[model samples]
Structure formats: C-alpha cells, structure tokens
Target: MKKYSLFQFCLGFILILGCVTWGTAFQNREAFRIGEITVSPGEMKSGYLDVPEKGGIGSRIPFTVINGAKQGKTLALVAGIHAFEYPPILSLYKIKKMIDPAELSGTLILVHIANLHAFQKRIIYYNPYDWKNLNRVFPGDPEGSISERIAHVLKKEVIERSDYLIDLHCGDGNEALIPYLYWMVTGNEKLDQTTKKMALAFGIKHIIIDKSRTKDLSQSKYLGNTSVLLSTPAITTESGYLGRTDQKAVLRNVKGIMNVMKLFQMIEGNPQFTEEPVWIDHYEVVRSDHDGLFFPLTEMGYYAAKGEKIGYVTDYFGEVVQEFYAPFSGMILYIVNTPPANKGEPVYEIGRVKEK
Candidate 1:
C-alpha cells in the first residue's frame, strides 16, 4: 500500500481545479476574425474581403461574422460561388439577420456572396472579366485572372480558417434541379465520417456519395472539395434551380444550415437529420459535344434507364447534331431546361441510388 501526504493531496486538488476552470476561462476568450471583419464574443460584424487587382480587375466579397458568447467551433457558410444560383445567396442574408450572437455557441462566418463580379453583372458560372468558372479554379493564383484572384483570397481567408464549411449552390439559370447534397469522400475515415454526418444533418433527402473529385491539390476544382482536401470537413449543397427566388428553396437552405448548426453543437438543439436518406452511389454529369439548342426528353428528378436518351442538341440551323443518353440507370438530379447548349458544358447530371 502507498501512503499519501497532505501536500500531495493539496497539489492534486489544485491541478483539478485549474483544469475545470481552464475550459470555462477559454470559453470566455474574445474575438473571431475573417477577412476584414473582427467580431468579439457575443457580437456580430459584417464586411467585405478584397480580392486584389490583377490587370485592372478586382472585386470585394460580402461577408458577415457572428461571434458566439462562448467558444466551441467555427462554421463557415459560403454562397454564390456560381453567381446565378440565387437561393443559397439569399439564404445567407436571411441567416445573417436570424442569427443572434448572444445565442450562438461558436463563431459563424457568412460569405454572403463569393462571386460579386458575376452577381453584379447578372451572369452565371464564369467571372465576367476572365470568362472562367470561379468554382473550377481553386487555391487560386494571386497573379492570375480575376476569378483566380478571388479563389486565392477565399482559400487563404475562409477555407483555411474554418473547422467546418458548407459551400452552398444551386442550379444555374439554364437548369432545373431537385434538392441534393454532395458528401465528398476524401479517402480519410474520420473526415469522410464527419462529412457524412453533415450531409445527413443537412436534411436533404438525396445525398450523393461523391468520390469523384480530383485528389490533385493543384486542380481541386470545386470549393467544397478544396476545403475537404485541406483536411476540413465540408459539403457542397444544392437546393434551388432555374435562377428563381422562390421561398421554398431559400427556406430549405436556411433550414439545412440551422440543422447543421445543431450538429456542430453551435446551437442548443438536436439536428433534424434526413428521415430516410436516398444514398446516391454514383453520379455523372453529361456534357454536350456540340454548340446548339437543347431539347430535353426527360425532366429533373425523374428516373432514366441506362442508354435512354435524356436530351438532344441541334445545330444553329436546326439539324440534330448530337444526343445525350444516361450512362446508367439513375435519377435525373438536374437537367438543362433552357435552349442553349454549348460544347463541353453540362447538360444533365444523373445519380444512381444505392440499392437496398
């Protein structure tokens, strides 16, 4: 048997007390920073993150930071990577108003609009100056074009700072889409699982078990994938379509983000996870080979059999130049609803559900 002294007991008691108080003390720590916005505990601030000028082209991204009363986790919600996707962009503005820092746990970063140039110009995917898709250029080049510069700033400011991230998006102006989310698998078990929970917590019924994103850091491509590859748990969510501003799609984005807040314990509530999630095992974005008018034979959210013609494209003179068919039996996640179809651009995306 070992004997203990009063000195040892007192020392042990003091250490225990320090550990207990340390947590509470750390929770009371001040300040959360991102871009130009710096928010103290129990406060919210909004500002712009400047993308430096490159060849007389520059833009400011709108952002809002809500620092919670107690420190826990930092969640970054980004919208408008593709400017024409209106619902997600609108959702962030609504969340900025709805969230009270006094009631939150950790900090909340709202990237109100990542593609301000595109949004201001009333455009879709590409940045007007460079005519390049903002989402396609990740970990952007500081010395590159306008879109590349925007990516660089976001990589340094937003994605690198957050513990969890959600890149909000929707179908562009030309497409019709059903609500769904991409749960990116990074081939890392812990990260993959965290993202899986986020997808379920988001409450979107259809979830793609997406493993298709490139592993190459230089060409990470999408914003969500860029975040994930950098070891942050992230998801890309789509909840609206056709450049519409309907309340339903907008609210869906808000609800999903709120539910994710619960999942991270950033708020005092349980996450409302999807009741029966439709697991999409595989997905393919069918691209057009010809520049012409597109006529869809099937609608978004409907099922298409393997080899079934989903749409067709005709030349400028109305000669059928090419036809698109489903590569596999799956659900039409999104399809071009408008007339224009260009070469090497997506006409539709199909997802095959995991069999029971």
Candidate 2:
C-alpha cells in the first residue's frame, strides 16, 4: 500500500510538470522581437525602426508591437504612406493606445508613419530628398534612393515578418475620395481568398478586387501588392479626403481596423462587416490633358455612364481647355480637389462595378 501511494504521487507530479511545460511553450511561441525590442507574450512594446541615413542625418519609423497572451497570427498595420492622409494615421494612433496586450491573441504591429520625412515636412506624395513616391517603390532596393531604401527596410523588417498586412491610406491633400478597400487577386487562390475575406470584413462599403491592374506584375509595386506577392494575405484601405481628418472618417477607420483584429482572432469578438459592399472588378484613371484648374461636375461615389462628361479643366484665362469624359460606366473612386492641375495628373479614377 505504501509503495502504491508513492507511485501515484509521483505520477501526479509528473503530469503537472508536463502540463506547465506545455503551457510555457505555448506562451513563448507568441513572443515577438523586432529590431532591438523583444516583446514577450502578454506585453506591449513601442520603439522606432531605424533606417539607414545619408548626409549625416538618420531616420526612424515608430512602431508598436502588441504580443498577445495566446499564440495566433501576426498582423502588421501600416499607415501614413502619404503624409497628408491623416485619418488612417490617426486611427493607428488610437489603436495603439486602445489595444490591451493581455487580452489579445497573436501579435499586432502598428506603423504609425511609414513616410517619416513626408509626414514631418508636410510633403504630399514623395519623400522630400529623393522626390520618389514611397507607395510606388516597394520591395525596394537597399542601395537605391532614400525612398527605395525605406521601402526595402519595410519589406524586410515589416512585410516579411508579418503573416498578414493592412496598409492604410487616405486621399492626398489634393484628392477627394470615398472610403474603399483594395483586394489583390494574386494567383495564389488561398491567399487571394483570405485577402478578399479580410477586405469584406474591413467594414468598408466599397471593395475593389484588382484583377486588371495587376495583369502586368511590373506595375504592381504598391505595398499591399508587394506583400501579396510575398505570399502574405494583405489589403489596403482608403478613407478621409481633401487632406482633412474628420471625426467620422477617423472613427470609420478605427472601427474597420478593430473589425480586422477580430477577424484575425487577435481580439475576442465577431467582425462587423458591411451588409453588401460594392465590389469593383476593373478601374481606370482619368488624367488631365491640359494644365489648368479642374472643376468636377459629379461628386465622389456618383455613377457615370460611358462617354459622359465628368469634369472639365479651365486654363488661367478661364477658358475650358479640356473636358474629361468617362470611358466606362462606373463609380467615381477618386478625384483631384486642388484647383491647380497639370497634364497627365490624375483627375478622377472610375471603378467599374462588378455584377453579383
């Protein structure tokens, strides 16, 4: 009887030890490390992602990492690809503050400002030093220009490290746009489906499934596209317009991102999705043919028939130099709001609505 009791006690102790070891391993699996910061499970760490600098000046991109208590997927939320697009960036700031690491699963990485120079100097599209649009250059060259180098660093440090990605943008200082999300239809069926699901869950009323734009892979250099190419499920969203960050726009973005977190199981809730989003299959940009002031006859989200006159441009003399017409019947996705215009500058983007 004494021998049997000792055996039972030893068996119980071994089982308890095994269970503790397994729990520790599971928690450790959720720990994340980026740059010099190592965030363990149930912890949140904020720091800067250092980028190589030239001309005696260095730059850093601010990042917040939320490593959850449970092991799951890793998501990277990026904003401020354009300096003046404030809604998305503001949403990220709120997300960083509101999320609780202890209540999360997996990890959430937030990049508040991807274009540091542009954001700091109030530049519109491109980096001041390189004059290169950060969005146009992705999976960038390490030895290339400042923008390219920044892109390269992001590709390596952020995109490659993430299991999923969400790049946020708003209309530039000169643009007016409706809230929408871009879903890339990569050849990878699984990734494409995952991205589409995420886009639908983003709480946006408009979702553009990009099949035509990426027909030529060389033209697909946006951060979201690049991330998709790397086999990571990714989506890009646009809200806000005309360079302003309204409370409604910011709240929409915040709610959308939170919905995404829920979709990823990083947060514990059902994702709130739009009932039926307008899915666009193809899109075309209407460019200005003459340098002048642009006047849009239709508002954003308005549908235009093919060959319909959408806008016109007037030269400095107040004479209409060019009248813009829609090439296809579609919803207006984007339009330039700034008075000044130049030849070949985008005046409007028409998204061809897809039939269910």
Candidate 3:
C-alpha cells in the first residue's frame, strides 16, 4: 500500500510538470500575435515565396508581418521597392529580428525585398519592356505587366492597408547619394506641420521638403484620403550609391527608423537623439557642361560660398577641361564624387539658403 501511494504521488507530480510545459509552449506560439498575415500582390502563404511572372523565371520574395499585442495603428516598413537597393532590405531584416511581437501595441509590416525579379537579375527595376522606372510607377496597374501587376497589388493591399509608410532606398547603379531623407510637401498646412514633426522624429538630417511642381498623382498624394485619410505621412531614405552597401549608413538608417517609431509612441523607450538634424529647403543641381574626366576638389556636404571653386574637370591628358563653382552661398548636399563626368550630367546639388 505504501509503494502504491508513492507511485501515485510521482505520477501526479509528472502530470503537473507536463501541464506547465504545455502551457508555456502554448503561450509562446507565434500565431498568438495579434498581427494579421496577408500576402500582398500575390498569394504567398508562407515566408520565402517564389513569385512567377509570365515571361521570366520567377524570383523569390521573402517578407514577414508582425502585429502588436494591442490594437493600434499599422505602420508598414518596406525596402527593395527598388530592387538594387540593398541596405534598406538588410535594415528591415535586422528590424524584424529585433522586434518582439508580444510587446507590440501597433502593427508593423515588413516587406524586406519587394522586387524579386529585379533583385535576382541584378537590375534596378522590373521594367525591361517599356524602360519605365519602377519608383515612378506607384499605385501600380492591376491589369498590366509583371511589374505593374505587382505594384497594383501592393497599392491596393499593403499601401492602402497601412496608417503610415516608409519606403527605403539606396542609389541606383552608376550613381552615389549622400545619406538624406526626402519629405514631399503637398502645400497643405496641416500636412506640412505633420511632415516637419515626423521628420524631426525620424532624426533625418539634410531634409528636403520638396514642393515639387508636378501635379501628377503619385502614390504619396493619392493614398492620402483612404484609410487613415489616405493622408499617411511617408519618407524615404537615400544612403550609399551604386551596388555598394555601407555598414555605417545602414546603422544610421536603422536608428533613424527607430527614432520615428519612438516619436509616434509605438515603442516604449526614450528617444535617441545623437545630433540635432540639419534642415534645408533650397537645392540647386550643378550640371556638367561637357564630357571629361571629372575631379572633385571638395566632398559632399561641405559648405561653400558663391562662385567658390568646388571642383574641376580634366581631359585624359590631365589638362583642365572645366572648373565647377558654387552658384550661391550654400552647402554641397550631394556631389558626384565619381572620377568621370559627361556634359549635361548633374555633378553636385548645392543647398542654397532662402531668405526668410
């Protein structure tokens, strides 16, 4: 009788341990996350999906969407919207691993690499047919080519589904861009205020609040009145150039995105402010007048006075071909540091000060 009692006690203890283990496992299940999972622009039901186009061998597009524990605004983080841009996608990958969905109070959609076809082929975009730039084709066509179809689905499914958006990018091949964040101004007073606030929140220096003259309905403008008023504030990060990815720039961008999240109160933490960001509105593009071997005396982001010699162009024989000068008192926001230059090509972008 004593032996039977001991055996029963041991069995009871084992059962309790098993229940605790199972309970813990159930609590940790990833699906318990409040985030909804939907494959955009296609029916990709799992991570690392191979999307097949009509003509080419399909490419693999990997993505993950993590929602917060409590219901809140959905913020979409997308990279490789332009395929050749590597840093943003890498940053997205890092951001994905760092987030704990259980602690989130808002939805975070991460599209690490959007243009698989362009990425696989080492192309800047998926427009081999009409030679259209992919960035220009937003809110894409539903009944169009492969790129258009993909864009269409993205616009309808993802872009329309989010409260805020961030399109990450790097310089295309054959060009380099100084790290900067672009904020498009719609001339709307409220939006402009919100834009400035969001820009500061993101901690992006070298901000260009562009009041572009083009009236064509772009994705940013068109998406303003939908869910979240289709008026979601958007920003893009331009860092590094050509097929190269810089680790430092990537870190800067990652921190920048995190800063924005903190600003919006999506993340529970103190805001990281390493430096006071610089704000600039006037930008003047310096174009080359003739083809030559280009040589820059000064680097990008250097302040220069009006008519100051910034760089000089030379022929293959080392003879001075052309001398580039600052058009106004401003800082060289973006300079073509490449050794070669051609006529009518932009060499530097001078940020001139506007009289207040």
**Per-residue lDDT tens digits of candidate 1, residues 124-217?**
8898999999999997889988988899999999999899999999999888999999999989999999999999999899999999999988
TM-score for each candidate, following the candidate numbering:
0.92, 0.92, 0.72
Q: What is the C-alpha lDDT of each candidate?
A: 0.92, 0.87, 0.65
Off by over 4 Å in 2: 1-15, 55-58, 215-219
- Where model 3 places Cα greater than 4 Å from the true spot, the runs are 1-61, 124-130, 144-147, 213-215, 218-229, 272-275, 286-297, 308-325, 339-346, 353-356
Candidate 1 has its poorest 10 consecutive residues by lDDT at: 26-35
Candidate 2 vs candidate 3, TM-score winner:
2
Higher-lDDT candidate of 2 and 3: 2
Better of 1 and 2 by lDDT: 1
Q: Which parts of model 1 are misplaced by more than 4 Å?
A: 1-28
Ranking by lDDT: 1, 2, 3
Superposed by TM-score, candidate 3 places the C-alpha of residue 170 at a distance from the truth, in angstroms, of 3.3
- lDDT value, residue 131 of candidate 2: 86
Residues 146-227, candidate 3, lDDT per residue (tens digit)?
6655565566656776768777776655455667766667666786666566666666666776665244544532222221
